[model samples]
Target: MTSLVRSIWGEPEERKLLFKIDFFVLSFVCLQYFSNYLDRANLTNAYVSGMKEALGMTGHDFNNVNSMFTVGYTIAQIPQNLLLQVIPARILFPVNTLIWGCLTMVTAAATHVRHLYVIRFFQGMAEASTFVGAHYIMGSWYKDSELGTRGAIFSSSAQIATIFSGVLQGFIQVPLAVFIVSWLQRPSTKNLDQLHGIAGFRWLFIICGLITVPIAIYGFIFFPDTPETTTAKYFTEEVGLAFILFCVP
Candidate 1:
């Protein structure tokens, strides 16, 4: 990054474009990370909102949900990584991300207690690629020392999204309820049932889905698959900085 920064800010105009591309690409990368977290965390938000009562979820059931998610997540890591090699990450990752986002929304539709288990298992499968895959992409492009801050920033989006979910859940509850009324014409009445039933869950899922779709598009449109193959159209200088940062480690 230091190399790219000096090249862009101090070097001749001919070298500046790549550095600019690098900056925009990283910016897109970080923002997708933020949305990635938001989808991952909507479960916690759903729990507090009404998934518990609507589905009669016990502590054991919830624990099992997490447990199943963990198992599925762990099981898929190796295969997912292998799949990365077989697939074009720029295509595979974003398309899969959007699919995961859609799955996240469908989770709100779970009616029986067992439904949560099944959905979470699959969600785990979808999300399984994220950690290892992200690092794989990062390591492919970034040098060791330079990866620290970029990785930190990317990782930190999870924490940021978690904290923000609390506030978002609180504020969106009523508005989401109203949205449910309009979208599905569900329950045909106003009450906790209306606000906390399948319609309500659908609304939350739909919201999470909407937010994730654009990030997936950004990944497809803006983020580079690797330093060797960056395709940023407007900022060549930034791309060079990203290349230099990846090279440092």
Candidate 2:
């Protein structure tokens, strides 16, 4: 009975302790995604905010902008994936994200139909890299058993981004804007509905752009090239388990 109890209570050799990198990496991925979805859905928010009325856009223009983004997205897809293979993802992903962030902010600057087309085109190219690149990174590093969890996490990120945007615009955007207006001596936002002669939709783009800074910095500073290259704080066993988890899927 004593021997059996000892065996049952013993630690498994394969078990690992928790680590900070685990937390950092997971949070960075999710944060990047939250900003990404917020930026992407800003157009939809703009539509709801009477941006179409302000800009005199018909639903046709909105549809055209979305379609144009899709076309650019399709054309850029394969090359970007290939590029992710050759270029260091650490450098490439952040740069691409920054471009998309700026383009998203510039969406507010659209004065004519052509402005939307141009911004959306570049924004599509910038946006295409991260999703495919992140998936590829997970695939390269994570094992079969770990793949499902990674994929699930990735999917949940997308869902969360969309949900954040929807909930903010649906329930919180106006109230939040009003609060900002009243709270500050020099508000970070002048008026979400109108800023610098641009419609409020553009301001949302700018907000999304700014919001990504911490995450982009995190990726640049912490995302290692490989498991062996990591400088992030983790126990030896934790690092080993991370690779094991990566490969499991």
Candidate 3:
């Protein structure tokens, strides 16, 4: 019984390598997932808060925007995943993240529903790689039994971001209201229907974009591409070789 348990659980060195993989891969992927969801859902918050009125949106404009995003996301899914095979994930993942984050920031400049449709569509294409790509990287590092739990943790990050999105909007509103009233010399935005102040719903997109950009940069610098391709110093040559040999099969 003891021998069986030891064989399944792995030796101490194997456990240590697993921890390292989990810490680096899981943390980066999870943060990226969180930011991705936050960017996706912020539009809803913006619409209800002020963006809909500000853009003169009517009828099914909001739904149309979402549909455009979904269309772009669906279209990119296969190509992006296939591209992942040819490109280094360290480059592909972060570049995709940077593109989406830039598109998210550009949402601040949208003056009409048409503009939103365009931005969201391209943003969707940029983000299409994240979940699948991250899963691929995780699979490269973690064993079959280990993959499920880590994947669950990574997927749950999106839900966590959903919860965090509302709080982030509320938190941003407070400081923005203060800055507008005190520094920008604008009237209190409390009763405004359509956003007239400098710090409108646009800031939500901008802030989310800013937060995502840094994370993307971090991933570019530190995210281990895969066991076979990674050059991160933390994963020494021996560690990398062991992980590839252990997990590749």
Candidate 4:
């Protein structure tokens, strides 16, 4: 089994380094991508679930909010990617993730549709780094043979999050709706409309944000950047040098 695995991957030393890179780099990117999609999916779900009525969203407001997000996303893309040239990926990626997570949480406090517009635009700006940054990091670490599979795995995370979002929203909405209906019928003293002064849709954002922030924190500690400049404790000086030499044409 070990020989077969080594034959498909690389020699023992290379396989050892690859395993570490896969654990630290690939895992972080996939989780970050998953969280990115979760925030986006939650937003659309929130809009349909209750955000429209709660925020008094009028004609074209939702579309405009998405447009604002797109503009911010587009404006930041080049700048963020260029930053990777000077700034370390460990620093840049985690900081960006943290910013977007906070923005996602801030969406819960929005009292007006304009608030959503501002929040989403900045959120987009923060998220602009994730996809391209992941690709760049993967290219830095993986050789041609290994890169394709890792890229596919990373891309699939977004799709998995999309499917999970539907299930998660259903889980959140169904129970809350049923409880509110029961409370309304029973004439309860406590208000069931909002849970602890937060709407269901708002809770969705909060949950997604909560899920995201930890991943950012994890990235800060564990992300290995690239072979040339890695500070990861798991990768020795020799391993980093060997990996760099292997990638050279």
Candidate maximizing lDDT: 4
CA lDDT of every candidate: 0.68, 0.65, 0.81, 0.84
- Give candidate 4's TM-score: 0.87
Select the stronger candidate by TM-score from 2 and 4.
4
Of models 1 and 2, which has the larger TM-score?
2
lDDT of model number 3: 0.81
Worst 10 residues of 3 by lDDT: 185-194
lDDT of 1 by residue, 153-231 (tens): 8788788877766656654555444453465434554422344444444556667777788888877876667656656
lDDT of 4 by residue, 81-116 (tens): 999999999999999999999999999899999998
For model 3, how does the per-residue alpha-carbon lDDT over 1-249 read when each residue is reduced to its tens digit? 344334544477677777888777898899899999999889998888789988999999999999999999999999999999999988888888889889988998888899999998998898999988888888787778888899889989999988877876775566444443344344544521234654457877887888899888998888888877778898665464574445455
Give me the displacement of residue 73 in model 3, in angstroms: 0.3
State residue 183's C-alpha deviation in candidate 3, in Å. Answer: 10
Best by TM-score: 4
Which of candidates 2 and 4 is the stronger one according to lDDT?
4
RMSD of each: 5.1, 5.9, 4.8, 5.4
Residue 166 deviation, candidate 1, in Å?
A: 1.2
Q: Evaluate model 3: give its TM-score.
A: 0.85
